[model samples]
Target: MTSNDAVLVLVVVTALGFDFTNGFHDTGNAMATSIVTGALPPRVAVAISAVLNLGGAFLSTAVAATIASGLVDSQDVTLTVVIAGLTGSILWNLTTWFFGIPSSSSHALIGGVVGATMAAAGSSAVKWQGLVSKVIVPAALSPFIAGSVAAIGTYLVYRLTRGVSEGPRGHGFRIGQVGSASMVSLAHGANDAQKTMGVITLALIANGTLESGAQAPTWVIVSCAVAIALGTYLGGWRVIRALGKGLMEIESPQGMASESASAAVILCSTNFGYSLSTTHVATGSILGAGVGKKGAVVRWHVARRMVAAWLLTLPAAALVGALAYWTAHGIGGTEGVVVIFVLLVLASVAFFAASRRAAVTPANVNAEWTGSVLPAPESKEATSWTPGST
Candidate 1:
């Protein structure tokens, strides 16, 4: 391969590599509740998530344009800037994963790019109007929206199941949880997976290989979808652990409600070209579900921590991106690519190894959650995740 082609390949590969991390890193967004409440096995959930995520990639390419060459000035962007931005985001992702914090991968990526672009070019490199409308507003609103819907759904679940037997109710809720969880998985693939597609496609367009405003190539979409799917299969046990059992006690009914609520908001947002945070959705749903239940205690401390992480995610990644931009600018493209590749590999490997200490598998996925505390289910459970509930 020619040197330029080789470097281009590396850029695409790194973009996909970030996609892979995005998948596994955010796998908890879809499966945490289901796994916690015994609605789906971790492995089964990831498998379903993988398939649906690829399927979701086919939904639209509008959001991709927002990330690529739109929100940021493509004329000011370079493959090096993209690479540096991706690396910064990846580092932030790995850092949060190790600590089991479910931060916004979407914002992290955007922050990285914004920082890198500003450092490399100037503030004018970012489209402030687009940024405020597309990303900032969504990031601020999505979690609260998801949480409110989940809270209402959870309350409605209890009210609906009031006449059911405890044992039969739990069983029925388990069944219902299955369906709701599956919908979240599918919805997650549709929304979160597309972000990576947009990033890589953006890189291609920025480099002048693909014309601006072109759709992501089928190969790009398929490869990113598959990479993320594989990452989902690998799972993000730490984040799952944090989401399912750390912040709240996820009963089957609560799990079902939260997943359904998240599914609804995420799907609608994605279709409208809004890249909302899956972490925001899932966490808000879980918290809302918890609040909906009578006597359900939300450790305000835990909630506070998550909120802190959310507040810091963008700025942290931005700082990293700025640093990455400065470092790589001195090295130029070829060497910069090498440096980024090594850092991502090392970070990924270290995080993987560290996660082995408390491995969360399909068999033990629900082990951390409370088993007998939830209310019984009423009738047939539906397998769906709607903007609020299907």
Candidate 2:
């Protein structure tokens, strides 16, 4: 294979790696509420999400088209830039996952690619208008929209069921959670999985293998779908712990409301070709559920920290992407790309090893939250870092 071909291969692998992280990192978005409320077993919820997410990936390519052409000029994107972008996104995903912060993976990927494009081809290479309309504006508004809907839905659910006995009401909501959570999972697949397809398409275009304005190929779509599905099946237990238990104590009713709201907003955005962040929507919906329920405690501190992380995610990933581009460009040629890729792999291995030291497995994922994503020690459940912990 030629040098360019080799680089393309690496880029595809790296992009898929990012997709995998995106899956596990955001698994909580679709299934956390169900798992938390006992609507489904932890493993069972993830399995269902995996299947739905895979099916959802096949449902749309509009978002993929947007990412491939809307965010940046396809002509200016280079093999090195693609690799750098994926590197930035992958690192950021791992960082947030380790801390159990449910940050936006969509933004991370976009920021990385945009930042790398700017570094290699100047700011003019980025399509600012498309970024604003398709990504930025949606990011800013999705949370509020989803949150409002969730709050209203949650209020109505409680109000309508006020006459029912607690046992049946809770059981009914738990059953409802299954369907709602499944919808969110499907929506997540339609939205999040397309991102990897877009990146791969972008890389393909950058390499001149495909013309500009092309949609993702069937192979691209299938590979991305399977990668994300496997990641979802593995489950992001750390994030699941945080969203399911951290933001607020999610009940069956609240869980159902939040999941339903998240599914609606995400599916709408996906249909509109907006690269929305499911994490943002899910987090907002969960908080709104708390707001809607009577006397439910909303942990402002945890929400505050997550918001701060959301604000930082884009710029931070961009900075890393730019730096990676510079490093690769400085070294020059395929060797530069390989060096960065090797370093990235090493970094990933390091993070995985460190995580095992205080792993958050499904076994204790639902252990009572103690201001940490980590299970309390008495439960023999080791904990990872949390936004609340120093």
Candidate 3:
């Protein structure tokens, strides 16, 4: 009924919009390995990732608690500020996705909130020390940590099974990869879903619907969980192409170990309330797997592009956040938010429709990766493609 109410509604909607983008953008993290390794079909891979992510959403709230309460001064924030920040994040997400860049949606949201808050209430509104100590350092280093661990695990797997016959060794590792990939899927759900829950919680605080320090509500958790789950099912086909195809070709066991290692690290961090980048973790794991395997090709140029994306993620989202906040301010508050929201809707529909022109479905998912309709079957150690099966 009032301007405040309108802004609150807009903020909630925008936060959820960010959640959807988070789902697809981050989908590559959970399922790329499994899909590439023939551990699961593309569609089945997504379906599994979605369900497990939903289940993981219920497992913990420590990470969500950090985002909702730790980063910014919740007491000084406004629904308008939150809305503008989310707008920045959503726009940045689309920009990155359009180019098929796998950026960190979590950092994008944080940077958005910080930039908007600073723009709205000045620098005094932020707690930079806390932000850097909690988010930045871990985000910068965790990937390397996870990557090295994955490389070690991958190498060990091969060394330990060196004496086994090729047939039995391949079969055993294929089975192992399924479980490891599942662990990664579960870990992804734990981290990414909590991010949306945190945003919604922040919106509630900004709106005064909840106490400044209140915990995330059941409704917030469920709504975010379901939204993220649906997005995961849809998958971000672009990043999927890059991740499943571009990095080392993940075989059954190697993909499994990489995903599993990343999953364990992520879950441990979530429990500790640190929101590290899933993109960084997943990307690093894939790279590590590349290093562990013999003659594994690491495309330095493509990887350099991804590394560039990682570096830019926070600052780019922050710049967008500042701009969104100022734009909303210039347009006179709630009406400006409405304008942005309308644009977001139009942009989203157009993008999705355009994507449909040559939609990447499950059947077509691995096709581009292996240069064939089916990555049918072959000897595990066989490097070159079979003429008929890809």
Candidate 4:
């Protein structure tokens, strides 16, 4: 293969890698409530999400067009820029996953690509207006919109069910939670998987393989869908722990409300071609569920930390992206990209090794949260709760 072909191959691979991280990182977005509320077992929740995510990927390509052309000046994007951007995004995903923080993978990818483009061709290369209107504005407003919807839903659910006995109410809500969570999973697939397809399309455009305005190819769509689905099947147990148990102790009713709110917001945003963060919407819904329920406690400290991470996500990933761009540019040619890719792999391995030290898995995913991501040591007397149990 020619040098440009080689670079394009690497770019496609890197884009798929980013999609994989996006999948696992945000699996908690779709299934955390279902798993925690006992609506679905931990493993089962992720399995269902994986199938829906695959299906959702084919549902739309509008968001992919926005990523490929709207956000950055396609004339200025290069194979190097796409590589650096994916590198930045993947690193940020791993960092947040390790700490069990639910940061925005969408922002990380956008920030990385934008940062690399700016570094290579200056701020003029980015479509600042599009960034603000399509990405930033939605990022700011979606959470509030979703939170309000969830709060109202939660209130209505509780009010309507006030007359039901505890046993029947919990069981009914658990069934509803499964359906609601499934919609969120499908919405997530429609929204998040398109992002990687967009990046791959961007790389293709940058390489002159496709016209600047070309849509993502069938191969791109299928590959992205499969990659994300596989990643979802693996699950991000640490993030699941945080969202399911950290934000609040989610009940079946609250879980259904939160998921319904998230699914609605995500589907609407996807239809409008906005690449909003599923993490932000889901987190907001969960917080709103806490507020709407009587005597429920929202862990303000944890929520604050997640919010702080959200605020930092764009700039932080951008800085890394800028640095990666500079490093690759300094080295020049295919060697530069390969060297950076090697370093990224090494960093990923290190993070994985570190995570194994305090591994979170399905077995302990629902262990009582003792104020941290890692569940406290299980006691013999600790009772395991499942769906429909008192």
- TM-scores, all models, native as reference: 0.91, 0.96, 0.92, 0.95
Instruction: State the lDDT at 369 in candidate 3.
Output: 58
lDDT of each residue in 175-292, candidate 2, tens digit only? 9999999999999999999999999999999899999888899999999999999999999988898898778878999999999999999999999999999999999999999999
Q: What is the C-alpha lDDT of each candidate?
A: 0.79, 0.92, 0.79, 0.91
Q: List where candidate 2 sits over 4 angstroms from the true fold.
A: 367-390
Best by TM-score: 2
Ranking by TM-score: 2, 4, 3, 1
Please name the candidate that would achieve the greatest lDDT relative to the true structure.
2
Could you tell which candidate, 1 or 2, scores higher by lDDT? 2
lDDT of 4 by residue, 100-168 (tens): 899999999999999999999999999999999889999999999999999999999999999999899
Question: Model 2 TM-score?
Answer: 0.96
What digit string (tens of lDDT, one per residue) describes model 3 on residues 257-332?
7887799889988888888788889888888877887777877677787888878878888888888778877898
> Candidate 1: which stretches are off by over 4 Å?
357-365, 370-390
Cα error of candidate 1 at position 53, Å: 1.7
Candidate 4: segments with Cα more than 4 A from true spot: 369-390
